[model samples]
Target: MNEISSILAICGACISFYIGAGFATMQEVVQYEASYGSRFLIVILVAAAIYLYTNISFATNGNRLKLNRGGDIYGVYCGVFGEKIGKCAAMFFDYFSAFFCFMSFVVMCGGANSTLTQQWGAPFGVGAVTLTVLVVVTVVFGLQGIVNALSKIGPIIIAMILLVSVVTSVTGWGNFTGNLTKIDQGTYADVMQQVGGGNPLASGASYGGFVILWFAAFLSELGAKNKLKDVNIGMLLSAIFIFFAAGVCCVALIGHIDATAAADIPALVLAEQISPVVAVAFAIIICAGIYTSATPLLWTAVRKLADEGTVKYKAITVLAGAVGCGIACFVPYKELINVLYGLNGYLGFVLVFAMVAYDLRTKMSLKHGVENETAGIDR
Candidate 1:
């Protein structure tokens, strides 16, 4: 019973970490899935398969290798080439991932501002500053602090997202097929141009790729601390839940394609269509989702620079929060999501290839070792 609870906790944490501001807002779904029209289901399924594979690989490898730092997983993945090349690759990934994580933090702040302004007419600064302070304070408490908070908050937020998305999709089913046909006929061509342009396959791959980058270091660290069986099961569950929720959300968004395509926060817009009270409730839930994601991303970036609990770590945390808030206040949230996530997702494909290579090499070597051991025993 305790073991089952632990696995569920891990699953919830994984889902929560991946949810983030863009996802909870439906901005990510708009760009990656819903914009593709009738083919959105296929795109999400493709991404979900990739998510499961990458999560399992990172977690299991992290447990087996037990590296000193989470970032070291890159070194292991690249070491299949040569020691010198591996070190270079590791250094590159470490720095690039740190920058990426920080930029993602900036996106979270922007999302917070957008959500608040759209829902309650709050000042942009109010949301940005409020989210930044909360994130920085939580990050200061470090990894365990983050895990504890996310484990509890993650499940609740995911439940709320599921409920809202499922209800919206069901209620709006009358509009769904017609909206899909309109989308296929290019009714919203201009909106599609703004959100995305890639084919379903490329978009799906890119979606999975960027998400792999997000989980690489974090899951590796998690695997190092937990049992392999538990980590594997947890990640598998997370992958299933994420894609299922995304698919449902995509259906809901498609049913209201006109409003969703134009709105900054489509999920909130859909909820508002249901009731102002539900919209208000979902706004708070979205804020919580943003908080859950921002905490780990900030921690990942800062941890790369300084050890937790050190004075340097705390100082960098505050400074990052400030800079991120400043950036979020100026940049449009949609622009940030469209540009950063799309570009970085392609870059993440490179890491995905590296991870595949590492996995293959490891399996072959293990097979060879087993063969040699059997021969010796027979002799």
Candidate 2:
């Protein structure tokens, strides 16, 4: 692929990967739109810009490290953090991925069940089984194959969302303009109240926590364990995609019923409103996203346990899948989201600190900063 295609592919992977079950519904926007309010877009823009910068920065260093897997980079950061603390952080982050992945798996089932139940009175058990099978097919193909397919499907997801939202609004005979005007009038404040946080000030600690969590969600750095093509474009494209996604979600929020539901899963809710076909499209999109979240989780866990043998490799993958599937069975959809978000927030705090320390060390050798050069292979 040429530079443009390469970058877009990277971009597709980075941005589309994050558009998981949570993002499509309303979790992402609620964090920004509800907690942050009209100011939410500002946070979305800023977060996208910062994430874009970090992605590029990470790629620049990761390629130099040529570390083969992301855990190596984590090791470097861990060393700088003091072996004890660093190892602890890595363990926390790595395992968290597994927990998050399983939770998402269950959610995909719930989402599919939700759609099926709403249509043709189909039993949820059948829908859940179907969704699980579909996910396994994609996983069996491994990350590269999925990425290849997503390079096409990712943008299509975005386009379809935009098309649905725009078409819906237009067909509304321009009530879109007036209907959206209600958004700024304080509907967000009410929604947060329903979600366990009364108001931003009252829930200051809680909402502040979410801002931090969003930062931690960016763990893979575009899955650039070693070298990826179109390094710079890949990341920038992700930023733009995120910004666009945030906008589409908000439009759905302002246009839909549960103006308060804006905080939930706006995409799926919006899809349900647009048409049954739209809902199915969103379901497929959610499944695709769950795959994205599932990866870093499985990769992190498997890396810790497996060595260079096929015996260990297959073992790790199965373990990861089993653990994740088990969690899906037990965890409630929204509770899982809250836990993931909170965990991301705390981890983000540490990562940002690492980012700062790394920057300082890079600028001053006296600080003993590692330039992300491959230090040594991990055992």
Best by TM-score: 1
Give the Å error, residue 150, model 1.
Answer: 0.4
lDDT score at residue 180, model 1, on the 0-100 scale: 92
After aligning candidate 1 to the native by TM-score, how far in Å is the CA of 63 from where it should be? 0.6
- Residue pairs in candidate 2 whose N, alpha carbon or C atoms collide under 3 angstroms: 25-265, 25-266, 26-264, 26-265, 26-266, 212-345, 213-344, 213-345
lDDT of 1 by residue, 137-230 (tens): 9999987788878888887887888889888898889999999998888788776533336488788888888777678888998898888888
> Candidate 2: misplaced stretches above 4 Å?
34-36, 97-110, 113-121, 125-128, 168-229, 257-265, 291-300, 307-309, 366-379
TM-score, candidate 2, is: 0.76
TM-score of each: 0.95, 0.76
> Weakest 10 consecutive residues, lDDT, candidate 1?
370-379
**Tens digits of per-residue lDDT for model 2, 1-379:** 6767777776776555555555655554565454443444555555555565555545655565554554455454445576577777666654554344444455555544544554446764554555555555555554465466556656766666576666544544344445444445655444442222323332233333333222232333334542455756666676676667666555555555344343345556666667878777765666556555444334434544564345666565665555555555555555666655555544544565665566466557535653434322233
User: How far is 78's C-alpha from truth in model 2 (Å)?
Assistant: 3.1
